[model samples]
Target chain A: MTTFETSVPAIEPTGSLSDSVKIHGLLAEFETPGDILKAAEQVRQAGYRWWDCCTPFPVHGLDRAMGIKPTILPIMVFFAGLTGLIAAFVLQAFTNSSGMSVWAMVWVTGYPYLISGKPLLSIPAFIPVIFELTILFAALTSVFGMLTMNGLPRLNHPLLGNDRFRRATDDRFYIVIEARDPKFFRTRTEAFLESLGAVAVEEVQD
Target chain B: MSSIRADQVGGRIVDNTTEVPGTRAPLVLNMTTFGQVTAQVAKVSEAGRAPLAWYVAFAGSLGLLGLLGVCVLYLIFTGVGVWGLNTPVAWAYDITNFVFWVGIGHAGTLISAILFLFRQKWRTGINRFAEAMTIFAVMCAGIFPGIHVGRVWVVYWLFPLPNQMEMWPQFRSPLLWDVFAVGTYFTVSLLFWYTGLIPDLATLRDRAKGRLQQVAYGLFALGWRGSNRHWHRYERAYLLLAALSTPLVLSVHSVVSFDFAVSQLPGWHTTIFPPYFVAGAIFSGFAMVVTLAVPAREMFGLKNLITLRHLDNMNKVILVTGSMVGYAYSMEFFIAWYSGALYEKFAFVNRAFGQYWWAYLLMVSCNVITPQLFWFKAIRTSIPLMFFLSLVVNVGMWFERFVIIVSSLANDFLPSSWEFFTPTWVDIGTMAGAFGLFFTLFLLFCRFLPMIAMAEVKMVMPAANAHHDEDGHHHGTPAPATGGPS
Candidate 1:
C-alpha cells in the first residue's frame, strides 16, 4: 500500500471478482461513524469531488467534513411557494371577484360574488386559501425537488449490488469513490482508502 | 442524577423519567445499539405473522370499519334523515366528529414538525406512528364532511371547479376555506411522513427475506443509497417541510375554527375560537397519541425506545395544552358576560345549565379536571394512569366539540327553531366506525410499514457522537451523553 503515490497511473484493482465485469467504484467500509468521518475529512482534503460518504443515518457535520456545499433547495421551494401564492390569488380573484374571463380547460369568468353586500375581492377572505396553497406547493416541491436532485426512484444502483456495502444502511459506514472520478486510480485509491482505516474495502460493479 | 435519586422523600422508587435536575438522561435506554434499533423496528414488519392481539384488534377494527361502510351506504341511500338532523340542529354528530378527528390529527404534526424544529430528538421514537395516526385521523375526518354533504355525488362542488352547472364554489365561504385547509394538511402530512419513511424503508428493503417484501420495500425505498451528499439535501428538505408543516398544522385548525367563528351564532362567533381550537387540538391529539402509544410500545417490545420519558414529556404537553383549553373555556364565558350580548350570555348559560348540561360538564371534567392530574409526576409516568386519563381526555375532547356544535346550533335564538340534537343509531355507528376506520388503517400501517423511524433513532445514539474517534470497531461501548431534553 505504501508503494503507491497519488499521481500513480490508473491501475484496475484485481483479484476480487471476474475481470470481465466493469468496475463502478471503490467502496471503503468503516465500522463506526467516527472512522468514516475521519476518512471523509482526509478524502475531502485530498480533493476528490466525485466521492460520497454513505451511512445508516445522517452523520452530523459530515457534509462539512466532506466539503459539501449548502443545498439550493430552500430557494427553489421559496419560488415554488411564491408561485402557489400568486396562483391562489389569481384563482380566487378570477373566479370570485374579477370581471375578466379566460380559458382554462373551460371558459372561466370572475363572478364578483357579493356576500351580504360585503366588498368584492375580499383580501381577508382570500388569505386562508392562499396560505394553504403556498404551504402545499412548497411542501410538494421540497419532496419532488429533493428526489429530482438526488436522482431517486431508480430501479437499481451499482452500490446496491455490493454485498459488503449492504451494511451502509445498517451499522457500517462507507465511502464510495466512483471510477468516473479522474482522481480514482483503482488500486491506488483502494490503497489510500485502506490507509484511512477502512475495516474492509470492496470493488463495486456496474 | 445521584442527588435526586438519593433524596427519595418517601422511599418511593423514582422512575428514570423523573427530572434529575442537572444530568442528561440518554434517550434510548437499556443500552441499545444501532443494528439493534434497525432490527427491532424492521423485524415487526418482516415477521411472518403478527401476534394474536393484533389479529383480534384488526378483526374488531375491521368489523367496526364494516359498520362504518354500512353506515355510509345507508346514509347515502337514505339521505341525512337517517341521523337526527332537525331544523336548528342541522350540524350535530357530523361536525363534532369532523372537528374531533381533525383535532386529533394535530398532535402528530405537532410531534413531527414543531418538536423537530425545537430539536426535540425524543420525538424520533414516536414520530413515525404519530404521523401515521395523523394520516388515518384525517382520513376519518374527511369521511364525515363528505358524507355529511348528503348529496355526496356533488361533493366535488366544494372545490372551485368548472362543472356543467357553470358555477364555482364561493371562495369567500369559510366552508370552502375548510376544504382547502384540510386538503393541504392531508397532502403535506403524507409527503412529510413518506419522506421520513424513505430511509427506514431502505432498511426494510435491505433486510427483506421474501420476494414480496423486497419489491414493496424496495419500490418505496426509492433506491435511496443514503449518500451524505443526498443527506445534505434530504436534511434541508426535512427542515423545510418541518418549517412548512409547523404553520400548516396551526393554520388547518384555525381555518377549521373559522367555519364556526365567522358564523352569527354566539358560541360559534368568537375571535378566541382559533387559538382555543388549536390548543384543544394539541391537547386531544397528545391524549390520542398516549392512548395509542401505551399499547404499541408494550405490544411491539419498544418499551426501551418509546421510554417513560417520552410519555412523561407528552403528558406534560397534554397538561399545558389542556390548561390552555380550560382557560379558553372560562374566557368564552367572561367574554359572553362582558360583551353584554344576550344570546351570547344565554349560549354560555344554556351550555352549562340547558338541555346539554351533561355534555358541557363532561367536557369540563374530562378535559380540564383530568389533565390537571398530569401536574403530578407520579400520575404522568404511570402507564396505566396516563393511559386511562388519555382515554378520558379523548372522550372529554369529543364532548367538548359536541357541546360547542350541538348546543350552539340546537338552542338557537328563536325558541321555535330550538331543538334537541339526538343522534340515531346510525350516527353513533358512524362515529364508532370512524374509530374502527382509524384503527384499521393504523393496524395495517403497523403491520406493514416500519412502525418506528429506525434511522432517526440511530442518529441520536451515543455511539453516533463525533467525539468517538477511537471507534474503529462496531461494538464500541458508548459513553452516555449529557445531552437529552432538559
Candidate 2:
C-alpha cells in the first residue's frame, strides 16, 4: 500500500530558514494539459511516488497517466448517510414514541404528543427528517472527507514560495517531483524534466 | 467555412464567429479565445470600481433595506396584530410571501445542481448569480416564519433542543418539518456556493493588485494550489454534493408543501401539492433568474458572455413550468368537481368567481396567459418583452399563493366565520423590505465577487488552451495521445 503523507507541522527554524533549508522540489512548468500529462507519466514510469501535477482546471485522462488510484469518497459518503438515517430514526422514535421501561418503574418521559389523532410512532411523518439528515450528513461528509483526504487548510506549502508557481491556478500547468522521493537526484531529475520539454524549471525552497 | 450571414434568428445576428460545423447554432456567441473569456469575466471584479448604474442600483436597494429594517423593528416592538391576521384568514401575506420567496429560491439549486448534473453547459453563464439569489431569497423567506412566531425571542423553541420546560418540538407537525427543511436547505446551499466560489476566488486572488484585495481573496481561497490531486477530490465532492442537492431541491419544496398538504384545508390538502408546488417553484424561480440576469448582464457589460441564447433558454423553461402550473390549476378544478367534495368544489369556485376573483384573474393572466406569448420566437428572445414578462410572472406567482391561501380560508365551512383579509401598512412595508434585502445582498455580491464562474466558462470555450505539436503547428483538434509516452 502506498501511504499518502498527512499534514506535517512546520518546524520552526532557528535562524535564516530559507538559507539553511534544503530545496523542497523542482517545479517544471508546462504550457498545455498534454505536456503535464506526458511529464507526469514519465515521472510515474520512473517510479517517483512523491510527485504531483498541478493545473488550472481538471485535465481529462491525466489521472490515468499519473497512475492515481480512484478515491474512496463514495464509500465514506455512504456510511455517513447511513449513520444519519439511523440517528434520525432513533431520535424520532425516542422523542415522539412511547414505552421504554426500566426495572419496575416507567423511566421514559418522551414527548409523545398526539398530532391530528395520528399514531405516536408514525413512520410516514419521520421520513422527511430522515431524508434531510441523510443528505445533510452525506453532503457534510463529502466536503470534510475531501478536505481530510487531501490534507487541506494547511494554509501554506513550499511550492507556493515559487513566484512562477502562482500561475498554476491561472493559464499554466506544472509537474513537481519532491526531493523526498526515493528516485530523486538533483542533477538527474533536473535533466529528466528539461528533456520532457519543460518551459522553465525552478527550485522550490521550504 | 462561411461565418456571417444576412439571416437573423430571434433578433440576433447570425454571426460565423459562434458557428460550429454540423450544428445549427452556437452555444456561446463571440467567445473567440481563452484570454478574452478570462479578461472579460475578471474585468467585472477587477475593474477597481463599479459603473455608475451599479452604484445607483445599490443605493436604491440600500434605501429599501433601511425601510425593511424599520418595518421589522416596528413589528417586533408591537406584535403580529399590527398586520392583518384575523379569524378565517390567519395566514394572509406573511405565509404568502414566505412561500413565494422560498419558491423563487428553487431555480438557483435547479440550475446550479440539476442542470449541472445533466451537463447543460449554458448554466455556466448564470449559475453563480442564481445560487447567490437562492441564498438571499431563503434569507428573506426565513424572516417571515421567524417573525410569524409572534414571540420572536422564543423562536429557538422551534428547534428540538433540550429546554428547561422539559418539552420537545412536535416532530410530526409539518411546520416543524419546515424548520428542518429550510434550515438544512440554506446551510447546504451556502456550502455548495462557497465550494464553487473557491477556485474563482483563487483566480481573483492571483489577479488582485491591491493589498486588501489580495488578503481578502487569499483568505477565502483557502490556500488552493490547484494540485491535480486536490482537484480530483474537489471534483468528486462537487459531484456528490450535486447529487445530494438534486433530491434536496425536490424534498425541500415537498416538505414545504407538506405544511399545507398535511392539513385539512380545502384547497391545500391534496396529494398533488408536492409536484404542483415544485413546478410552480421552478417556474417562478426561472422568471426571477431572468428578471435579475437581464439587467445584470447589461449593467456589467457582459453581453458577449450572457448572450441572448441564455435568455431564450430561460424563457423556454418559464413557458414549460408555467404550463405545468396552469395544468395543476385545471387538475385541481377537475378533481374537485370529479370527487364531488362540496368543500373542495366551493374552494375552487370561490378562488375564481368569488370576491377575490380579480386576484385569480391576475394570477392566470400573468402566469398562464402571458407566458403563452413565448410561443413566438420573437417574444422569447426580445430583451424588453422577456424582462417585462419575467416581472409579470413574479407578480402572478405572488397572487397564486395569495389566491391559494386567502380564497381558500376566507370561505371555509361556516358562513359566519368567512371574512375578507386585508393587509395594513406594516404588511406592505415588510414585504417590500424583503425585496430590498434581496437586492441589497445581490448588489453587494455583484460588486465584490466574481459574478461569473471564470474557470467553468473557460472549460466550455473551444480555444481554452493553445495546443502545439512538435513541428510548431497549432493543432485545432485535441491531442490524440491518451496517456503519456509508454
Model 1 Cα lDDT, one tens digit per residue, B203-223:
888888888888999999999
- Residue-level lDDT of model 2, residues B234-274, one tens digit each, is 88898999999999999998899998888898989888999
Query: Looking at every candidate separately, what fraction of the true A–B Cα contacts under 8 Å does it contain?
Result: 0.70, 0.47
Q: What is the TM-score of chain B alone in each candidate?
A: 0.93, 0.92
Evaluate model 2 with DockQ and give the value.
0.33
User: Highest DockQ among the candidates is held by which one?
Assistant: 1
DockQ of prediction 1: 0.47
Per-residue error at B274 for model 1, in Å?
Answer: 0.4
Model 2 / residue B208 / CA error / Å: 1.7
Candidate with maximal lDDT: 1
Q: Extract clashing residue pairs from model 2.
A: B3-B16
